[model samples]
Target: MNKYLWRRIKYFILCIAGLLLALLIWGVIEPYYLDREAVVAEIPLLSPSWQGKKIAVVSDFQIGMWMANTRTVAQSIDRIVAERPAAALIAGDFVYKPGDNLTPELDRVIQLVRPLVVAQIPTYAVLGNHDYGAKAVTEASASDIQRADRIQQALEASGIQVLKNEAIVLPNADRTAENDRLYLVGIGAYLPKQSQPQQAIAQVPSSAARFVLMHNPGSFAELPPGTAPIAVAGHTHGGQIRIPFLPEWSWMSFVEERSSWSWISQIRGDIVRVSGWIPGYGNADNRLYINRGIGFSNLPIRFNCRPELTVFTLQAKT
Candidate 1:
């Protein structure tokens, strides 16, 4: 009888071990094979005159790995441009890693999309935590900083303005005149080593219709009261996994809280909260739009959530 019990226990242990191994592979390795989902969100800001303006939002294209095919990336950009937005906003993470030789390929991708940038629509970008991973990892070498600089130069040359805790006003159709009706503010990646967002938003005229570009959603919590009308971000990558009924602690939880997992709630008081600009304020306001992102991070697979190119139409509230 004792011998029989020992045999049953061994089988149970083996089954548990096998299940664990499968889960590890699914989470870290096989995830790259999953298809990414594309989604669009229409947000209304405080601007009544600027309503009907369309803005394209793209974020977290790690580039070389999941998006290695320049043609694929180009095609995606073409589709986005087809929407004819007044402006394009990139939330950050252009390159996968510092040492990765994605320059030539990235340059090619940029060339395909160059026409869109040079077009009437203004294109703006900000760095993400991965862009400054070398700095975050602590062991990053001098070469890392040099690589980061090179990437920045290339992106700028491509006509995509890279904002590092800075603000730039986008002129309306008049070109020569400053359009106080709308403003674009960019905050550097929320990584502690980078510039602070509080300082970046300060550069913009507070009275204008403020549209903030930030990489991580968490940065919204740091903004001063009544800063911007809407803040855009993409770093959470939509939790990278969206299994129904399961606890969200799977993967993205390791980074920011689950609040970082999706379009977050807007905080409001004397200041405009990130969620305020949404359809509703607090839980109701449409304050922030977090992109699911294009490329894969850490692991190569994506399931349920396909890569997305977000086109937001800003209409005047009736």
Candidate 2:
């Protein structure tokens, strides 16, 4: 072969070999490293008399992703249990895709999460964009809805209350007519296709000490004035990547109007509410905690940002 042709051939072979090596490394190291991140933040929310009661937050269970393993998720739940939280809040995306396995995977999740519920920790969940994305996999809108409903049902059966833009007052253990300390309000997925936030917050009493749960962080914008003391959300997955000094703009840029990358924002209004991200607790009122989600999305690889299970300790400010 001519020198020119030989050189070209060698370069091409080298390129292919490099690509293969990169893929191999990613396949082996990605799953273990990406899937193995400790639950980062332990937020403290002060109540009048409640001192050390903790609420565990688990979000973005994008099951069925190539990078996410069911075992890892179960382990994460186990960690949450170890924290001995008073309650567990799940912000949506229970399934990666709507498929025959979707229901089964959801069932598996229920079984794994059942112990936590049985432990008497009030578990609450809200749907996410992916849960409703079953239309893409099922091909039929009705089937998608049915599949989502099934997931919800399974969760409820396992003792997790599925909140669809509804408010449920959580009674204190004291049950004393005097100590009405905790209230949990959940909003549905923040899709225009699903329920509306305005309608959801309407159900909650403005004067109550509320913890609002919603799928998308952006939904906080729509909350009625003086709605909640703390809002928990999951969807951004901490941008899925963190570069040194450079922000993860891939998802933030497009979602700027809908969900800004700002993890914490104070909603100035009659009530002066605050909306904070719940994936990894960015720059919000120290009250908002954004969990770095348990499952993977789109690319199936997590860099810098690892999955997290957050535990928030609600204490008395005084």
Candidate 3:
């Protein structure tokens, strides 16, 4: 081959090699790597009594999925147990797709998370889109719904309080004041049928310091202001396959959010209305934080963003 042709051939070879190496990192290594993030925030309405309280959050365990790492799940839970946060919140997607191995998979995930139960932390959880077992974001069959119900029961049996369009008022550990309280409002997932932020918020007293929990960040728009000064969710997985700083590059988002190229904006706009209002393009009040969650769905690869387990410390916004 001539020198020019030889160089072109060499460049082509290098490009192929680079692609393989990247695949190795994204598909193999990154999925298992635990990215611990401090979800620190000072919300405007946080009560003085609940100051300096910490809450641990995990999402998208999605066990039984093709690339769902059970080992990583243990590490994340162990770390949270060690931290001994005042409370722990699991944002759903505990089991990926309950195929024939649903029974075995549920057992596996329950064991993996039992440590949290034994640790005695006030834990809470919500159902995710996948948990519904629907066909591409639509409601699943009765059997699928039954499967989800069983999983919810199993989780509750493990001592994790699964919240569904409900509010639970947990007393402040400090106990300095008789009336000190922290409200936890857990809403249903937005994808299938059970998303009702309105119902959950209606039960919470506006003056109470509350934090809303849900699996999908898209539900943030449905939440009214003052309900949750800071809402926590994880279904977006922070755009699981983010491309450096350009969100548009993350085409994988479309697949997960149930949209086609034709009406991507409308779908996402409906799903993530909050992303448009915040200063950085998120919730209207900038009170929502979408956890870059752990586990993968459909695809095993993750680039730029690693699996996450977040610890949030909240103080009154004074």
- Identify the candidate with maximal TM-score: 3
Per-residue alpha-carbon lDDT of model 2 for 106-197, expressed as tens digits? Answer: 76677778878767777889988778773121233676677778888888888889998888876567444434556677887654356566
Q: Which RMSD does model 3 reach against the true structure?
A: 3.5
For model 1, residues 68-112, the per-residue Cα lDDT tens digits are 434444555776677777788888887666555756646754776
Ranked by lDDT, top first: 3, 2, 1
Model 1 CA deviation exceeding 4 Å by range:
1-48, 66-72, 100-102, 118-120, 134-143, 174-180, 245-250, 255-286, 316-318
Model 3, 1-318: lDDT tens per residue? 799999999999999999979766765777778888886766666667677888988988888887577878899999999998888899998888876458888898899989988888888999887777753555657877777788899998888889999999875667565347778899986777677889988997766667888887667666665456688887666556665656455635667545312123433332332121122333345467777778886777777667788888887776
TM for candidate 3 is 0.88
How do all the candidates rank in terms of TM-score, highest first? 3, 2, 1
Query: For each candidate, what TM-score against the reference?
Result: 0.71, 0.74, 0.88
lDDT of each: 0.62, 0.64, 0.75
The deviation in Å at residue 211 for candidate 3 is: 0.4
Stronger candidate by TM-score (1 vs 3): 3
